[model samples]
Target: MTSAPLAGCILAGGLARRMGGGDKTLLPLSGAPMLARVISRLQPQVGAVVLNANGDAGRFSRFGLPVVADPIEGFAGPLAGVLAGLRWARAHHGEAEGVISVAGDTPFYPADLAARLMEARGPDAGRIVLAKSDGHMHPVFGYWPVSVADSLERFLREGTTRKVLAFVNLHPNTAADFTPEAGAPDPFFNINTPEDLEAAEARARIEA
Candidate 1:
């Protein structure tokens, strides 16, 4: 079945503590900024793409797309990024039924991700859809309904300290199972530290 079209969001507003204080999205991986590769992969799948980055949007202007900041402060993690994307989608692409978010540090995401995720959403509204691989769940790569703005806002205002999975557990979430291509490593690998960046480069070379 054909899935509903989605708005793609690259969650690039993190502090990058593990990779030093710089923006991990701008870091090079396999000769391309990690953010660029993510855009290239998602652009074809979604109706439109936006960067959810904070502080000085000019840095991402070269990408020639809208960059939005979290409505809440104190860097509330990926959930805040998700909220920003949902807000953008609602304002710009209100007709879009949902938004798909991927961390900027993850460049090797699956090609069929949007379809798989939208499929998992089923008939539910405000449902979260996450990807699972090798018995581990990658909550950062998922689809969320645009209607979540109010709940997310309330969570932020209430000073909720729950992690992404904990917040997700509060709602019904469908886990999409994806088997790695024969001999291919997991596609949702994320770069967090210097060692992870090196590993991603090597993996990219092998996949290329």
Candidate 2:
């Protein structure tokens, strides 16, 4: 089946408490900002791309992509970033069928991510799609319907402050599994702490 038309959003608005409260997306990974690498990977796969950030959108203006903030208040987490992205997609790419959300810190995201997730969606099933690696689901890296904004808003309103997986499970969705290949590490590796950054640098060196 043909894949749906998708727009991409890099979730960069997280309160990086674990990374010492700085913009993790702007952190250097292999000499380039992690956000740049992520945009490079996602731009070719989706119709449009935007950065979802809360404070000082000007910090990301150099990328020349539109910056969107959470429509809800107080750093509600990735789900808020997703909601901002959905609204941005609807406003900017009105023809887009769905929005594919990816973490800015994940630079090695699968190149076929959009196609794979779109393929997993079925008629009558909810419009959420998650990625799986090593038997664990990565709900943040997935496709979401633009229509889900209302439901997500309600969830935020009810103070349902849980991780993305909990929200996904409450809806109907499928997980697309991917296994490591040819000594390659998992495509969903995320750099949250300094140790992860070191490992990712080593992995990049090896790949290079």
Candidate 3:
């Protein structure tokens, strides 16, 4: 099946407590900002791409993409970032049916990520499609229907649970399994600490 038209959003609103409480996405991974590498792969997969981040937007001006903050305050997590993306897509590109969200710190996500998610969703536009690997689910990386924006906003305001899995369980969902090439780093490798960044740099050099 062909992929659906999806607007991409890089979720970069995390506190990054494990990485010394700053924007982990801005950290250099192999001589480039992590967000830049993410956009390089994600741009072709979707109609448009936006950065879902909090605080000063000027820091990301170099990327030349729309910067959107979560609609809810106090950094509500990936779900809020997804909502922001959904809203932005609806406002800026009405033709997009949904948003494919990926972690900004995860630069090695597959180039076919959106295509696989859309393929998994098939004809059901309302179904939430996420990525899975090695028997683990990555809820932050998913295709969420723009129609669920209202429901998600309500879910955030009405409940204390900020977990993406808990919110996704409220609706029909599918997981697209991905396996990396032999000897290649895991496609979902994310940089949350100095060690992860170092490992990613080594992998980047090897993969380069």
Candidate 4:
């Protein structure tokens, strides 16, 4: 943890075009809603948690987290969710230094995500921190400084590129590497399509 607390952002705002649309995160994994699994994993790692979704906030009301929508229109992607998280953190979690964003569709992200990223933050770093596994950077799972909220909004409004990496590159950032335990499913495994949901169900059964 830094000098201030950290908040969590569950980015459930995706259009899920591949999963045939709708909220893929709300789909059940095993017996519980997949979003529930994500909240359970992320809640323990932060001072507060909020859900980032586009519509029908009531659908997620059972989870008992504040729902924040992308501040920018046109569903500007995950970066917009990050901005929402940052703004929400600033307003509600004034004591929090930043927000740790994770995909709502990803059920098994590392438990130590917040710690690893905070640990990797050197003295010169008020920078954004991202998660990396198997040499692939998970941009959606990142540590974002609340102070960057304005800058992120500007980046989105510029319309140059809404890509997460494009904005990340504009600031000083680094990635924290995560290695799955032997014989365990990749920690970042997420449910996107029916096939991915099937795999998650199987993984959930084995873990159960």
Candidate 5:
């Protein structure tokens, strides 16, 4: 657990353009929906989990989590999803001091994600901590403080660029390095295409 309570947010709003446009997270991974694997990894690390998605929330009903859409419309990018998650945590998970945002298609995220993020924080109360693997920062797998809800909303509503790093860079932020286990892929490896999914399965097989 974090020194402060935390909520989990799975960002699933991407259009999956490279994969022919659809919910890529719902696609199969090792005989089960990829998102099911995501939930399993993240659920243990936070107080509660919410799905950040857009359109037809009913499609995710089976997951039995509150589905929140980006507060700003027009597929405002992962930053919007992060903003939505922060607002939702502030409103519903009021006890949560922050929210952890994970990319829904990235099923291999580290199991100790939340704990490492908390460790990466400075003495401040609301530092943003992102995951780093092999020197690359995965901003989508981030810890966002509920206190940044208003600033994030303003960033989405007011800024022309919607990149997650743009806003994250504006604040106190650091990355928690994750060393790949022997025979394992980078923890933040995500499936974005048919070939990528095949590669993921092959990698999973190697690890198994």
Candidate 6:
């Protein structure tokens, strides 16, 4: 089934407590900021891409993409970031059918990530598509229908669990499986600590 064009968002709204309370996406991996690597992979895959982050937006001015903060106060987790992207896309890119979300700290996600999710969703405008790898579900890496923006807003306002999977399961959804290559780590592997950064460099040497 033909898929509609999508708007993309890198979810960087986390407080990054695991990495010592700073913008983890701005940290360097292989001599480049981690967010730059994510942007390089996602930019070509969607119609428009934005950074969903909190705090001073000026820090991300060099990226030159629109920076959207969580609509709800406090660090509301990935679901809030997804909602921000959905609302932004609905407002700015009316031609887009949905929003594709990715973790900002994950640099090596598949280049065809958005394409696969859109295909899994088929022509169904309301279906959510999530990516899975090695029996683990990556809820944040998903395709969300823009039409459900209202539903999500209510979900957040109600202040139940802020878990992404809980909300995604409430809607019709499909998972696209991604198998890891031999000797390579899962593409969704993200950096959340100094050791993870070291590990990413090690993998980059083999994969890059």
The parts of candidate 3 lying over 4 Å away from their true place are 1-3, 181-184
Model 3, 50-140: lDDT tens digits are: 9999989998999999999999988788999999999999999998899989999899899888888888898999999999988899888
lDDT of 6 by residue, 1-208 (tens): 2246789999998778989988989998888898999999998899899899988999999999999999988878899999999999989999989999999999999999988998788878899999999889999899999988998989988957988888888999999988786765789999888899999988877777
lDDT of each: 0.85, 0.84, 0.89, 0.87, 0.88, 0.89
TM per model?
A: 0.92, 0.91, 0.95, 0.95, 0.94, 0.96
lDDT of 3 at 79: 94
The predicted structure with the larger TM-score, 5 or 6, is: 6
**Which residues of candidate 6, in runs, are more than 4 Å off?**
1-3
Model 5 residue runs over 4 Å out of place are 181-183
lDDT of 5 by residue, 1-208 (tens): 5566899999999899999999999998888888998999999999999999999999898889999998998878898888888888888878998998999999888888998888888566689999887778888988898888899889888898988888988998888889787766678888888999999898777766
Q: Indicate whether candidate 2 or candidate 6 has the larger TM-score.
A: 6
Q: State the displacement of the C-alpha of residue 94, model 2, in Å, after optimal TM-score superposition.
A: 1.4
Candidate 6 has an lDDT of 0.89
lDDT of 1 by residue, 26-86 (tens): 9888887888889988988899998999999999887898999988887788889999999
Write out the backbone clash pairs for model 4: none
- RMSD to the native, candidate 1? 1.9
Name every residue pair that clashes in candidate 6. none
Q: After the best TM-score superposition of candidate 1, give how far the Cα of residue 155 lies from its true spot, in angstroms.
A: 1.4
* Model 4: per-residue Cα lDDT over 77-117, one tens digit each: 99999999999999998988889999999998888889898
The ten-residue window of minimal lDDT in model 6 covers: 1-10
Q: How large is the C-alpha RMSD of every model relative to the true structure?
A: 1.9, 2.1, 1.6, 1.6, 1.5, 1.6
The pairs that clash in candidate 2 are none
